[model samples]
Target chain A: MRSVTAENITETFIGYFGKDTDPRVKEIMASLAHHLHGFIKDTKLTHDEWRESLELLKWTGEITTPERNEFVLLSDVLGVSSLVDMINSNPAATSSSVLGPFHVTDAPPMALGADFKRHYEGEVILVEGYIKDTDGNVIPGASVDIWQTAPNGLYSSQDDEQDINSFHGVFTADENGYYSFTTIRPVSYTVPSDGPVGKILDATGRHPWRPSHLHYIVSAEGYRSLVTEVFPNDDPYLDQDTVFGVREDLVISYKPQAAGTFPKEGFELSGKVDSAFSKIDFDAILIKK
Target chain B: MRSVTAENITETFIGYFGKDTDPRVKEIMASLAHHLHGFIKDTKLTHDEWRESLELLKWTGEITTPERNEFVLLSDVLGVSSLVDMINSNPAATSSSVLGPFHVTDAPPMALGADFKRHYEGEVILVEGYIKDTDGNVIPGASVDIWQTAPNGLYSSQDDEQDINSFHGVFTADENGYYSFTTIRPVSYTVPSDGPVGKILDATGRHPWRPSHLHYIVSAEGYRSLVTEVFPNDDPYLDQDTVFGVREDLVISYKPQAAGTFPKEGFELSGKVDSAFSKIDFDAILIKK
Candidate 1:
């Protein structure tokens, strides 16, 4: 029998899949096998360690549900999601960010200047942004899908206290490429830490807080769709987002606005606040497909 | 907020766990983050690819159960288990091999020259081996744990048709440092190929056959335990073990013995007189702790 040593194992494995008809699959498997073997070799991984790693993976898998994907969370916390986003992102287009695990399809479509916070109770904020192309031309009829956690730091999907679709909406840019919505200012909150990924954070002493941000997936005809997030500059976790979703171009200041100074065209002030209202203006840029 | 690019994401992630109280966890997390990010960057992975990868991980995890561990099998098929074994193995001791997923604790102990195949229906074979130290001195009372698939190529644990503990036993070497057991000649078999690992193999056109071999875990007082396998030199799959568990020194020739030529000390001639028996002689060497 041929002796299979570490020195020859890699070649043997790669050879097994060398004849794969699918080039992409072949490429992926080869690279995966190579790096995986290299990591084990570099770490001089012990049998006990190997067992622990396998158990970790098993636990991670066991906790994954359609509503809560622990594997995606693992990829996020490991910064792999961000790396992949950066790699595939078009530099000339709006910078991309991590598409966190909370995005849901078929979000309720709302008219421009509508309120997404139907039952939310927090500091009200008005967000206005324009959808433009790299050439500075307005992209009319662009779709902007937005979602964020409630003030209590739990997403509408995760917290039963909030109404269905609270703090979530899909709006379209008008002729002027302008879209506006009224909602509560998002609060920085910890990522779900009750599962295996959370256990990893706790064991490593890594904080699980993600910066307060709004998730958006912007798209229009003939333009590349951009899935990203906009972060407030003042959040403590701005630089320490557990998922590393922050981008310089994606951060904007939430300027304080006097109660009467709120835009009358798209927003209605509901409360007399001393310092509880803010306004943020940002723009989304997309590249031609 | 700082723009999180591919280049900066790694540093940001490593910094999160830099203050980890456990240095080993810190080291492992940092290395894991680095390589994981490196792999993403090297592959220039696309968003679709990332999603597919995440989905693949989810499926791999979801399919895992107590009876079947897809992650460990993944490690095995990818040659990661073999590589880790090589890294941790003592070169001076008996060559180590993959501790396949079938080993179970609390195996029934038997006297020397016991028959492990209580209900087996195949060519009878006698396996005799000595337990020795690196210095070649006999290590009396050494424990030799052995397990293998039955003639139908299914391990006792996997095949319901076989009785519990069939083709499985733990024996002790005698004062002469010798151990013997009677079993049916092991037939080459395929690893379980109905899971995610098997799917990958099928997609890649790689066979899942492992060489016919007997699994052994040998240990004695004052010596480090050795976990390995012995393969019949003539097996066609010896060079193609799916898990890459074969080692040169672990392969032995099984001499065909006439019915009456078999050792009478522990075995009984129950079959015809032609060529219904085989004898294999091997030895196990352990390193001093």
Candidate 2:
């Protein structure tokens, strides 16, 4: 018999467990062992290499805070995050996207057609959309929560000292399933490159820019909620979204229409610009309950 | 066009990354976004749930030390370790067994018939084996590195922390591809279950115990090397190695032979018992170089 050594410690450890146990746990554990052993055997992995991987993971945990989730980023970069999502997300709803590292709670509720441009300057685009079921029935009283980036490419929350919700709002659709919000066109920008995910990108020689877009989560009784993004038709990064989240139907045309021809006159910005820079009619298709 | 707000901070962050980027980065990032978004969207996974997972990983790192590897243990119990092993262990050599997690470099080399039980006591069984090509030709100078648990069912390295190399040795084959080592019979025992792996085991309600066995790594200049474990014939745990590392061919039998049966002066057990307890012939098969 061979004396145990550090190299076989993993096996030595597993050699202790009894066979009578939950099959799921056993199967998963076995699968994990196969992959991990494969990695070591394939690489004939050295001790130092193992140590480095462990150390890197340590750094991954050390840098994560309540606000900054480096593990999520790590999982994201590893593709496990998405794999887990595929296993759980609603198959009928619009395909779910990555839950990024920055969502905080407690958004104030507001009404339709309300101005969400709390304190940012950009083209005041009227975002008019309908929340309808797949069968084309309007989902009246649907709630649509929306958010976007500043023209300077930063979120209000990114600045701890700022009171401005530069690009955030919560809006409820009217009885006719009509929803609209007044806000500025968002700008395309790069993700923060100071985290481990960023370091990995740097090491791998990759960029981190995302195209201009607006975020929306529309929900109502008796209808499937839709969490989606609408992108500008002409944004250069539209074709190169770092996260591969672009869908053709999800891209809205930014038409420069006449400002005075707009509906629902609040009596402001009579001639905001020589011509309306863009007016996009963005609607969502929610599944019937 | 909604303004960014505190409530949707996470979504805004995800949106910022999911919009656009290089094609290479896009595919990976999009998949990540989709999955992460899927986790939150599907589990309705609370922020605290996400934080808890991160904390679990953080503790996994904190508990790891220079002498112990928790992540590998995690990977092992998860089965990634064996998956990796299965993928990489070549089909050509005598099937490679789990390396386990305790191999250390710098083993002291010895000649044929040398003893490995310098600081332990048990039935002095003589283990002799042949190293040959698949064609049965003797391969001289092949090294047989061996180790086993002490009589108390613990590995010397695990129990005798102060005694370096207590039950580990390397023996070289003579001109006839024959090698021998004197040692006590390894006893079945439980593996360490005092860490996170243990907690997982307890949560799942599983016992831990490995059958009596001997570990061997055989290597010759012109033959493929092999790493394997030989289970004691009929050991209860043979069918339930917690690590799932048992292979039928690797099991050996112990026959009660007559005293002085060798009838050869070259191989003799000193301080032999009047009544022989157990004796066995163990051999290994190797592939061509």
> Which of the numbered candidates is closest to the native, going by highest DockQ?
1
lDDT of 1: 0.84
Q: Which candidate leads the pack in lDDT?
A: 1
Candidate 1 local lDDT, B146-194, one digit each (tens): 9998888888779888766777789989998999878888999998888
Clashing pairs in 1: none
- Provide TM-scores for the models: 0.96, 0.66
Candidate 1 residue B167 C-alpha distance from true site, Å: 1.1
Angstrom error of the Cα, residue A35, model 1: value is: 1.0
Q: Considering only chain B, report the TM-score of each candidate against the true chain B.
A: 0.93, 0.75
For every candidate, C-alpha RMSD to the true structure in Å: 1.8, 8.6
Query: What is candidate 2's CAPRI-style docking category based on DockQ?
Result: incorrect
